[model samples]
Target: MLTEVKNQIKVVFLSIKYSVMRELLNRFTFISNVIFMMLNNASMIIQWLVLFSLRENMGGYTFKEVLLLWGIASSTFGFSRFFFYKAFSLSSIINEGKLDSYIVQPKNILISIITSDISVSALGDLLYGYIMLVFYGLSIKSFLLFTYFIITGGIIIAAISVILNSLSFWFGNTDVIAETGNHLMTNFATYPDGIFKGIAKALLFTLIPVGISNYIPVHVIVNFDLNLFLINTTVCIFLIYFAFITFYTGLKRYSSSNLMSSKI
Candidate 1:
C-alpha cells in the first residue's frame, strides 16, 4: 500500500515537471503570459478600492478581507489551472475523442489527463495570491492555513470540473454545459458570500460550492472556526472521490478515436 502511494506521488511530480518544461520552451511567451495574468488580477483591486471608499464595507467584508477573498480564489484557480488544466477542457477532449493516448497509459487516467498540460498564465494568479497575503498581513499560522485551504479549494475546483465534464460521456456533447458551469463557479467565487441570500446562498454551498471553497476559507482565515474548517475539508474529500468515480465510470462509456497523435 505504501509503495503504491509513493509511486502515484512520483507519477504526479513527473507529470508536472514535464508539463512545466514544455510550457517554458518559449520563455518570452511564458513570461508575458504570467505577467499579463498578474496585471489582470491586480486590476480588480482598484474597483474594490473605489467601492470601499464609498462604503464602510460590502457584505460584511472590509477591503482587507476582500483582498483575502481574492487571494484564496485566485490561488485556488491558479493551482487548478496550472497543475490540472485539462479539467477545464475535459468535455472538448471527450467530444473530440482525445482520450485515446491517456487510455493507453498505465497511470491514473484522471491525473494523466489533467496534468497533460500547464497554463503559464496561472503562474501569475499563484503569485498574486501570495502578494495579497503579504498585503493582508502575513503570519506563520495564517500562511500555513492559507496553503491548506488553497490545496483543498483547488482539489474541489478540479473535482467539480471533472464531474461536470464527465457528463459528455452520457450526454454526447456537453462542452457548453461544462463551460457555463466553470464560468459560474469562477464568477461566484470572487464575490463575498454575505452578499448572497436564500437560494443563492444554498446553491453556492451545495451545487456550485463556492461557499465552502472561498467563503468558508475566508471565514476560517479571519476567525478560525473549527466547524466550518471541518465542513470544508469533508466537502473537499467528497468532491474528489465523486470526481474520480464519475470520470472512471464514464470512461467505460468512452468511444476513442484511433487517430495516431503523439503526446508531448
Candidate 2:
C-alpha cells in the first residue's frame, strides 16, 4: 500500500512537470496569459480599496481580513487550476467521451484526466495570491498557515468540480449544470461570507461549500479556532474521498468515444 501511494505521488508530479514543459515551449503566450490574468485579479482589489475608504468594514470584515479573503480565494483557485485544470472541464470531457485515453493508462483515471493540462493564467493567480499575502504582512506562521489553507481549499474546490461534473455519466450532458455550479462557487468565494444570512449562509457551508473553501479559512486566519480548523480539515478529507468515489463509480458507466488522440 505504501509503495502504491508513493508511485501515485510520483505519477502526479511527473504529469504536472510535463504539462509545465509543454506550456513553457510557447514562452510568449504563456507569459502574456499569466500577466493578463494577474492584472485582472489585481483589478478587483481597487474596488475593495474604494469601498473600505468609504466604510470601515464589509460584513464585519475589516480591510485586512478582506485582503486575506482575496488571497485565499485566488490561491485556492490557482492551486486547483494549476494542478488539475481538467477538473473544470470534466463535463465536456465526459460528454465528448474523452476518457478513452485515460482508461488506457495505468495511473488513476481521475488523476490522469485532471492533470492532463496546465493553465498558464493560473500561475498569475498564484502570484497574485502571494502579492496579497505580502500586503497582509508576511510572517512565518501566517505564511505556513496560509499555505495549509490553500491546499485544503484547493482540494475541496477540485473535489466539488469532480462531483458536479460526474453527473454527466447519468444525465448524458451535464455541462450546463457543472459550469453554473462552478461559477457560483467561485463567485461566492470572493465575497464576505458574513454578508450572507440564514438559508443562503447554510447553503454556503453545506451544499455549495464556498465557506469551507474561503470564509472559514479567512476566519481561522484572522482569529484561530481549533474546532473550526479541525472541521475544515475533516471536510476537505471527506470531500476528496467523496470525489474519488463518485468519479470512479460513474466511470463504470462511461461510454468511450473511441477517437484516436495522444495522451499528452
Best by lDDT: 1
What pairs collide in candidate 1?
none
Q: How far is candidate 1 from the true structure (C-alpha RMSD, Å)?
A: 1.1
Over 173-224, each residue of candidate 1 has an lDDT whose tens digit, in order, gives 8878888888888999889888999999999999999998889999999999
Q: Backbone clashes in each candidate structure, one number apiece? A: 0, 0
1-264 per-residue lDDT for model 2 (tens digits): 898879988988898898889989999999999999989998999999999999998999988888889999999999999988999899889988888867887878899888878788998987888788888878887798899999999889889999999999989888788888888889998899879999999999999999988998888877889988998999999999999999999989988887766656
TM for every model, in the order presented, reads 0.97, 0.96
After TM-score superposition, the amount by which residue 31's alpha carbon in candidate 1 deviates from its true location, in angstroms, is 1.1
TM-score of 2: 0.96
Candidate 1 Cα misplacement greater than 4 A, ranges: none
Name the weakest run of 10 consecutive residues (lDDT summed) in model 1. Answer: 255-264
